[model samples]
Target: MGNSQRNDGVQLQDERLRGEQLRDEQLQDEQIRLRRPAGIRSLQLGDVKVTYVPDGAIRLTPRGWLPATTDDVWAEHAAYLDETGHLVASVGGLLVEHGDRALLIDAGVGPLSVPAEPGNAVGAIEGGALLASLAEIGRDPGSIEAVAFTHLHMDHLGWAHHPAPGTDGPAFTSADYLISEPEWTHRHLAEEHGTSEEMLAALEPRVRTVNDGDEIFPGVRVMLTPGHTAGHAAYVITGGGRRLIAFGDAMHSPVQIGHPEWWATVDHDTEQSTSFRRGLVEEMSRPDTIGYGMHFADVVFGRAVRGAAGEGARWEPVDA
Candidate 1:
């Protein structure tokens, strides 16, 4: 070969090698972003500050949890699965602070850990750091004005009724337990899921049933989007010209943004849940809105973006 031709060939080979290396690095970065659970993350919206307080995390068996999904689907999206092949989900509360007052959405899974059982959709689950997370933020449990629950699930009711670390009574004693009117009236149904009758009774004295559209807190309103449960509620907080929809369990994993039809095994009404999920994704895709998925692994706070032309929406994580 001519010397000039040889030089051109070598340059082309080096360019190809560099391109491959870059692609590999990009894939690795994407994997790291999806595989881990989130720590504490916060964002300021005008006068309101919203935070995702760390409690602990859980592993979900993808196939078992979302029964509609297939092995091929998971194989195509393996980056979402951890080393154990289960989806990593962070279990925590959304702390909304406005000036001196604070409102906590979902009290986390409390100070308990349950090991994964064979044939179960959920793998090992652990929680107990919510109180410590609050302390780290310099907010006392007593200062929280209300504990607004999306549903009566044990994970969302953690500190509301569970005794604080070593205390004899439940933490947040001074705060009213704000529950959706339907969720409170239909509390019995929650026992079928995971909530205990004892927990319901404990909250009876402090429970306050809130109606849809009620401004439970300043700049925060109740939005009833039931399907996962009889009364699953998503709180909408508006401040600083932007709004955040704290959609609890409405969409567990960001993967659902692309497949809203895949229902969790625990959903009360699969059809209703799927329908709501579709609309929720559309709303989250709006420019001025942010969605909070308490169990959305490391991307707990993100916005849904519509795909190019004919494609569906995808989740884009927002940095705190």
Candidate 2:
């Protein structure tokens, strides 16, 4: 071959090889993001630190949990599902720390577990490591200043209401339990959703009903976005020119970022929940905002980004 032709051929071959390697790397990343469970992940937002303290995980029946989704949808998004054909959801609370002060967003499913039942929206689930997870990160449960909830759900109130292992009293005795005003006033409705009346009583003394826009902690403010429940609240933490929204059950899976209209079966008001989700997804897509999805499996922390024109937003997982 001529010298010029040989040079061009070699360059083309190198470009092809590089393209293949890039594709392989992207595939590997997607596998890790979709298939694995998340460990305790910590990230910094200026002076404040945010961590996802994993208590446990649950399996959600795709069609049953997200009634708006269909078999075809699951089939196309099989990577998000596990071997058992269920979407894996990480159950835990978000720990926010500023200097020596710490706040826990949710208590997690306490020292308990449940077996999967046929035809149920959820599958086998377990928790109890929240305390241990906290200890591993070197934060004392007692040091937590307050336990703020997005809503009164069993998983979120788990460690708050349930007793510490082998103890008669619940853990974090000194911390106040922060609940949204509406959620507190309509606490009775939580019983139908999974939180028991007994649990409500346990938290009664420490419960402090907060209003929207309340600055519950340094750099953290409550943004009440109900619909998942009567008074669901999302905590917005701002610092160092960036903000993180701990959008509790507003979205249980990363998939919902693209299809916010697919309300979960647990949502108290489907239309409202769907509307909030759409706005939430858009807000999270902003350049300076990140989202924390407590039940987003391994992809707990992510940013929503706009897709092609006419397409909905999609989630891009962020690493600590």
Per-prediction tally of clashes: 0, 0
Distance (Å) between predicted and true CA of 147, model 1? 0.5
Please give the lDDT score for candidate 1.
0.90
> Candidate 1's residue-wise lDDT over 1-320, tens digit each?
99999999999999999999999986676568678778889999999999999899989999999999999999998879999999998999999999999999999988888999999998999999999999999989889989999999888898888888678888796899899998888899999878998999888999999989999999999999889998899999999888999999898899999889989998988888999999999999998999999999988888999998878788888875
List the RMSD of every prediction in angstroms. Answer: 4.1, 2.0
**What lDDT score belongs to each candidate, Candidate 1 first?**
0.90, 0.91
Model 2, range 247-273, lDDT digits (tens) per residue?
999999888998999999999999989
